[model samples]
Target: MPVSPKIYHGNSTPSPDAELAALIDAHPKPSSLSEYSYGTAGFRYEASLLPCVFVRMGIFAALRSASLGGEEVGAMITASHNAEPDNGMKLADSHGGMLDAAWEEHAVSLANAPDSQHALALIHTLLSQHTSTGDGGNSSKKKLPKMVVHIGRDTRSHSLPLAALVIRASRAMGATVIDHGEVTTPQLHHFVMHANGHMLPSIIPQRCNESGYCEIMAMSYAALLRTGSVGGKGNVGKQRLHSTSTLVIDGACGIGALKINQFQHIFEKLRAEGCTVGLPTLHTVNFPGDGPLNDKCGAEYVQKQQLPPRLYTPSSKGAVSKRYMTSFDGDADRIVFHFEDEAGKFHLLDGDKIAVLVSSFIQDELRCIDPEGKAVKCGVVQTAYANGSSTLYLKNVVKTNVVIAKTGVKFVHAAAHHHFDVGVYFEANGHGTVLFGPKFYDFISAADAKLRGTSRHNRANIALRRLRVLPALVNQSVGDAMSDMMLVDAILFLRGWDLSTWSKLYSDMPSKQAKVKVADRSIITTNENETAAVAPAALQIALQAAMDDMISQESSGNGPKPRCFVRPSGTEDAVRVYAEANTQKGADTLAYEAMMLIYKLCGGVGAPPQPLITNRL
Candidate 1:
């Protein structure tokens, strides 16, 4: 017999006591007592340990909304690439990104409260601190701020109860909860950003089958086809491309699989509008049915393991050996590209390769938009974990300004926005997107208008036109798998290169990554860009000494340069160490020694150090 959880659910309206109270009463803190901290990706763990956290997050979410004067905020229920039983929640701001850094501490305090009553008291305190009735602090005359929270969740079993708890807690505080039911992580971001009038005041279609996301993506594809160069061929304008490109997708049997199914009809709509670009045929694998979510599949699995998702069989990989394939994480936010060569060896074109391709495609056009490089500068933003080779190419070959940011998406996104007209940011983990700043749009639009007025069939005119549309193709709010896939397909079509050509742009230096179970991972704070350690500065000295020792031992002077760094894993209870060298053996040795050093100096638990994952591709 099959059974379902009997958690209480509510819509926009708040419900009465019994059911909501019962659910809260049943969920207590974890028996093992893991300290809860709101880190990079929010609090994630086994589902059983997350219910109370969800309940408190809902209250803090309401307070966060109040802080913004009741502008609608978003709560996304997803662990994103974690195991089946693992579930998590992320609070999105009114601006379509993660919770404001300002509110993070308040959220952590609320989540760590002793009980629901204590959590409630904390929420009230937050309200009193930030809430005002136009008259300074008079408690008797103070009125609660009206808040609205837009909530969405991915398709996880634990998500159902957790979502219900969110609704209960939020509505109990008199906040309106617009339940978005099931959606990808990025889709929720799109919806909130759209609903909050951040981008445009358009209504997102209500029915799942009629979602306008496919249409928006199709527009991006159409924009590229109308003006982009393909294999040196001039744009045919409304004429269809003679050849069809195909992409094989690993859906990870999760939310991404369901979303991709809605896109086939989008091409027809574009054709009706007289832009006849051939739509890429999407062959989806691991589309959810009986399989568990993210079970040996998805971007995280492939990236972390340095292998294809277990569900991807050779036959389904690609009929031709030279085809391109990609995978999306559980909620479809991050993506990784993989291809099999003639000899059947797998090659990965991760975030690093993707950055190189994109920066190259736009650099010349961006330079022309502001020739003096005075107001509109184009650049690439990378994390410390980004491959050294990619950084070098962007800085030297592409001749674009390169900036390094902290390890998280929030940090990278900010750097991209403030400094560059065209900001291409990506973590080596395959989480990334391009940011077209305010000046980028103005410059590209002006350049296109001038070019259009001058020449009807010149290459500069076509290039300028395509450059203008590239920004729309990107979902600037956050990293999106669908948006990124379309952008990649467009780049491939423009370059007229198969996966093999794309892979040859630059080879990645061999690198290895491992995790050590530290007694307190938080103690491992980092320097400015997370490239060095802040506390016990000796850690940096040890890391640099190890790299120097390895380089000195290399017999060949032309070997790959040695580099290493260690940082605490924001999402886990372990510290992660990254090392790279010319050869795979050198990389392995460097990572091993680095992990051991951190384990010995810092308080490592259990055995010496355990290797979490390594990728030498």
Candidate 2:
């Protein structure tokens, strides 16, 4: 077990009133407030001001919960892999997902509410309604029990104090609270669903209208049904005869361990029910003090050649030699799969492979159920970061439409919701999600209906309930490790295919991504004049000219055309450089050469002193 860090406070503990006073005193007059804004990632600010930003976030959490019938709320305060100074807040509903856009707008309205008192009053009213006791009078009709709010933070230094402020605010509002210290966002979601003593009964006389409850109920049913069906049909007996399947989980020090444990426990129960369960056997890397692995250790770091021994060893004669391996990043919201081939070689199942496998599975399964066998009308969406091979595979091989969007899970998620029956999106970084169309949801729900009023449905639904547990999914959604694991498991289980086999479908182009910390985050931007304003105009011109020259030379087709995207880091005061080409050597050459040019134009190879420049590039 890892030793937890001690919570320390400065000489003085600041009260909300005192904290507000101090903030006002330090900042004095209010700036226009236009500088602070919210996006799909949520409200972000420098770590120095996170204390104040959290106060605002708390208010938003309360308001959103209130508007949604006073359900419980949660907030995440750590920037995933961003530099120390960058921090952000994600406000989650009771289900652990982002609040709907309308709710976000409402939160913004409350945040910008004309006066402080008005803002505070609006928050107070919502908190009161969510937690209100049915004490006499007409209020009884509308009053509800105090909502329970769970708060979790990441590894950043500022997360603890910021979390403290959030906890204090919830307690102040009379809402019951759970502070899951140092948990990954996905672990928090798992805690929200399966953990005991985590849920509080609603005080409202009317039945609670939580959006996630039905989803949870359905998941529980799905898990039970699937397990029972396998056990009842003697699938486990056949599995026992053949030997239990083995799976290796590499939790990249993220919160996904909890979900994997849940799967293990659930599988154990199935094994006891005469199902042949094999190994869960989790190998955790990147725990505290182990040093940061970042992209190098998790899915991004896994190359085709790195196969763990457990996945390679054969069990016995006449037994299937298939073994599975998966790894998750910091929060366990995304995942990548690995497997060993017959020749003892390892292979990676990148997002493209996952998309191909999932798209095919959905299409095939739906066709089996639908007599017409008409196309499912589903499309696959990806970002510029997607491998060129993936695009060709989807169109020519799978014969499905592919839509490429800008980088970011937000855009991908939105595309999934709006356009297709089954929309798949992934960042080459390994973040992905499968948006089940209403028809698919109904199909699954209907399949579940056949086993209604039985333990089978109840057990199976536990697994299925995960789909409805969106608050945690949404809250931890951005590049989450846990959610990704659960998602991959669900899809693989449904498809009944080895994830490793899917990676062999196509070869990927070599790619590389690097980051350079600039003196000022504001100095780097896609905006032309605004970016020039922060850095020297001459330097900007030189950098642009150099990039253009590189693009032109690379486009000549003597070698793989090198492509690069240079922009300011959203989560840090740095410039990010991403380059891809036909070969690893070409990709590295382009990145290195670009960095050299930028550094030369700026005056030196190393970062400037006072400006505090650092380059992972």
Per TM-score, the best of the predicted structures is: 1
In model 2, the worst 10-residue window by lDDT is 201-210
lDDT of 1 by residue, 1-617 (tens): 11121222322323323333444566666667656788676778788888888887876777788778888788899988887788888878887788778788888887777765565456556766787734342222455466888777888877978898888887765677778778888877776666676454222222121165566666766777655433234333332232326677888888888778667566755657765654567777777663677788888887767787766434554453235688899988899999777677888888888888888878765554455667577788999888888887887788889999988888988899887878898788778888876676667667766776665356666667677666556766788888898888777766566678888877888888778888888778888898888876778888889988988876545434778889888876688888888777888889998888888888888888654344443
Question: In model 1, which residue pairs have backbone atoms overlapping below 3 Å?
Answer: none
Candidate 2 lDDT over 1-617, as tens digits, reads 22232222212232333443343233221353444556656776667655555665664564455444556666776665444466777666665445666666656655555445555555555445544433321122344343556677776667888887766655443345666676666445444433222342121011121223223422432342244233332122122111113556665543444334554454455557764322233333344334442334555455322333121212331233335667665455556777666666766776767777767645544544453644345788887667667777778877878887655666777776677866766666667766655555555566457446656334344333333332222222234554455445544543344555456677776666666655565644454312122354554565555546656655535333446555555655566666566666666665665465445443332453222222221
Predicted structure with the largest lDDT when compared to the true one: 1
Q: What are the TM-scores, per candidate, against the unseen true structure?
A: 0.88, 0.64
lDDT of each: 0.73, 0.52
